[model samples]
Target: MSDALRDRCEELRAVVLELTTTTIEAMGKPSKLADVVTVIGKLRAIGDKGAAGIDNPDYLAWDRVYDASLQKMEDAARRGDAQEAWRAFADQETGVNLIARACTGYPGW
Candidate 1:
């Protein structure tokens, strides 16, 4: 992959990690809505960039996991369960590993 795409992917990974960390930390603990909003914003931004290097099944798996995580997070939010919400979000970050793996086969065009 080109350096720019690699950089973007790295940025996405960092955002996912941060989101997961924050979510885990917020579990059963007080959390600021602003923080959650910011994380969600970051997630949306990264997703909007498109799955440029995500052509492999691994990447597809990551996407599926990500989509599932989002659903769980929304459900938790609806239930007003802060801990569940955080935990689900944190778990979602695991998909980043799949994303990275998929990127390894990118054409880097």
Candidate 2:
């Protein structure tokens, strides 16, 4: 790939990372009411573009991570532990990165 194309991909990755961090930060409050669906929608769009860029399977792994993360967040909410919910949400960012890296064919998982 050309340097320009590689740069564009890096920029997209940065945007995704920023958005993910913002989502996690927004969830810090007890009743923040973060629009998780919207965030997820954006992520899905990114995932689609990323899949094309990487030419690798992404949907299955991405769905697994996304579902598990949401479930963890829901469980925390049900338990009435805002901090735990935020922590879980933040932790899930790791999964997001994993998926992103895998999409780009990062050497190791």
TM-score (C-alpha, index-matched) for candidate 2: 0.42
Model 2, 1-109: lDDT tens per residue? 3343344345456555654565565557444434444454555555444333333334345544666665565566565565665665556343465455443632222
TM-score of each: 0.60, 0.42
lDDT of 1: 0.60
Instruction: Assess candidate 2 and give its lDDT.
Output: 0.51
Worst 10 residues of 1 by lDDT: 100-109
What is the number of backbone collisions in each predicted candidate, taken in the order shown?
1, 0
| Residue pairs with clashing backbones, model 2 | none
lDDT of 1 by residue, 20-95 (tens): 6666555645454345556766776666666665455655566656756666665675565767776665453543
Could you tell me the lDDT of residue 31 within candidate 1?
55
- Candidate 2 stretches with Cα past 4 Å from truth are 1-8, 53-94, 100-109
Every model: Cα RMSD to truth: 5.0, 6.2
Q: Output the number of the TM-score-best candidate.
A: 1
Local distance difference test, per candidate? 0.60, 0.51
